[model samples]
Target: MAHSAFNRKESRGAHQRLDEGCTERDDVNFLKHTLAFYNPEGAPHLEYSDVKITKSAPAKRVYGGEATAQDKQNKEKANADDMKHVKMEVMRYNPETDDAPHFVTYDVPYDEQTSLLDALGYIKDNLAPDLSYRWSCRMAICGSCGMMVNRVPKLACKTFMRDYPNGVRIEALGNFPVERDLVVDMTHFIESLEAIKPYILGNDRKPSEGPNKQTPAQMAKYHQFSGCINCGLCYAACPQFGLNPEFIGPAAITLAQRYNTDSRDHGAKERMPQLNSENGVWSCTFVGYCSEVCPKHVDPAAAIQQGKAASAQDFVIAMLKPR
Candidate 1:
């Protein structure tokens, strides 16, 4: 995997090569699945197979800043007067009043740029004032509006209404008990995060001792994992977490790796107990869905895999040492 990544001379998605500035997709030579045959004694044999383009042709995706003021005003005006409406079947539950969770549909006037969060806001303000959900910072940064949209975990602020113009179903994040309408009890997830010791540990140095600095190379090692916003979307997408709630799960493990990989941190040994346990990195099946749903692209699956390798090496070294 490392060889293939290093050989690829382009910047695309999460894989960026410093030697090669962002280059156009090489569809002719590189649009294929690479198959590596392992050799225990020597370098692996590499082969490539043609990728079957199923739905659409590959194209360059451009990410831009927010819409201009005039554009926003035009869109808002169009949405307010537009007769077109989208049906939103939101999951409703009130433990204090309801026996079980139920779905309530609402028709929301929307424009091409209206997001799921916007529709929910309209429903709250207009149709159903009693409706309950969590949201803040209508942008994706807050990570408070995570929910299951059409059975797929997504940030409500990031999902556009146009993507599901016909209609859409919204529910609380999966792999968690519902606390109320579109709100899940996050106690377990938070506990798991705490178990990994998300912060720097055993740093006894004081301000008088001087600052702890890190090089760009050292920062690059764990920078990707540090982008996690604790949205819990990775937990929702993790089938392992769904099956066994005891598993440490993806985000927490990734956060552990973030600190473990920091050159300035000495917490790897302290955190090894959790990372080497039965419910640790060994529990992951590498489904990779966690990475798919991650808004920050933290790639928790890769972090867990790296943790497994480190744990295995540690076990061998421990076994070889005399008591």
Candidate 2:
């Protein structure tokens, strides 16, 4: 109800919130990166929810002393429910006016149900009408909302805001030039997607025969690779692409894999020459980041690795057969 009370600049803030019930430390690295500017040395406050936090110092452990298991669980749950909300300071960029990006803090009343995408939408609707970012589907399927949520490539729609208890910092996808606030040049990702010839390749005979017969079992082989939504999240997450822009990246590899595994396709033999070349499938070092950041679960790393195996097999059989 009191949005103004939470809104303030970084230099001043009289109200302080305490967090409690740290269920996991897995996100410590991510939090450290997101809130680094505000709490340079260490985390300024603890992150928890209304279900968490304590009124006073928690009872200390005594050697060999233990509370009933149910009692301990109830206490832990209570601590988690008492957590408080905090502010998120986000970096904003304007290509038309500002030479560089600047930080703008927002007092986002935290709730366990809040997501980074939800927060961004709230800010855009309430705090800043001019703020720019891309989002198609509120779900991760669209992949249009992929960006750096605290320096990690992720889909804004999928990243939960409450996960970052301290605060959050959002940025455009890394390794690409920003067009404006959160949009980056997707030309490279598009071109690479095109490079692998994403469309199905067929001979004149196949069309004459009508729909090429493909069994359900056959479709199963390549189903995973075919799930690609042309999202460039894999490319942004790929260090290989960062090192060598010419590298085809994961999405393209998956594209190629999609066609190659099709039962009726013969182009796998033909595409082998192109895929085996220096900047083709061979360039992938299998860093596995592409798979990690994929919002669609289209594992480009596995596709590329599988492509290499297919290529290797082709080479072996070609050499063994008649000259």
How high is the CA lDDT of each candidate model? 0.86, 0.74
The superposed Cα distance between candidate 2 and the true structure at residue 274, in angstroms, equals 4.2
Q: Stretches of candidate 1 above 4 Å error?
A: 1-79
- Worst ten-residue run, lDDT, model 2? 29-38
State the lDDT of candidate 1 residue by residue for 154-195, as single tens digits. Answer: 999999998887899999999999999999998989998999
- Superposing every Cα of model 2 onto the true structure, what RMSD results? 24.9
Tens-place lDDT digits, model 2, residues 1-323: 11222223331222223244434443323222111122555535333222233579778776555666567547544643665555767768888789987778886654687778877876775568787888888877777888887788888878887788888888888877788888888887788777767666774464667876778999999998888876578888888788988777788878889899988676776667667878888898888998998877888888898999988998899899997
* Reference-based TM-score of each model: 0.74, 0.67
TM accuracy, model 1: 0.74
Clash totals in order: 0, 13
